[model samples]
Target: MSILTIHPKDEAQETALKTILDGFAVRYEIEPDETEYLMSSKANEIALDKSIKQAEEGDVVKIALDDLWK
Candidate 1:
């Protein structure tokens, strides 16, 4: 199966597309807004950079695989 992302210009267009999909019984999921998603992704990148810096500076604890869930 493949996934398709559609960016409708407005609510009317979105509604129209959804109606057609509903009529055809096509399963679909509404995703987070693009702008909001991008903002969140940026925040994650920043956090990852900080974590990498800490690891380089020996600021992380080493946990054994078996102790990870303890």
Candidate 2:
């Protein structure tokens, strides 16, 4: 099992990663960054903190298309 930390800005990239990983049955989790920063409402720092903490516990993975071919 592994955890992949991806910036939400590149959502398309993440989707591509999911597809490649799915083919191989590689377990993974997505860690989302703070979203309230973009909103005008109150901050959601707690959610951001929790996501970061979850990421720290799992193994990190870098998604590369070349890896899929190997």
Assess each prediction's global lDDT (C-alpha) against the native.
0.88, 0.67
lDDT of 2 by residue, 3-41 (tens): 556554576987888898899998877643446353334
TM-score between candidate 1 and the true structure: 0.47
Q: In model 2, which regions exceed 4 Å deviation?
A: 1-9, 36-70
**Clashes in candidate 1: how many?**
0
Q: Tell me the tens digit of each residue's lDDT in model 1 across 1-70.
A: 9988898999999999999999999999998885556557777768777888999999999999999999
Task: Please report the candidate that would top lDDT against the real structure.
Answer: 1
Candidate 1: give the clashing pairs: none
lDDT of 1 at 23: 100
Model 1 spans with C-alpha error above 4 angstroms: 34-70
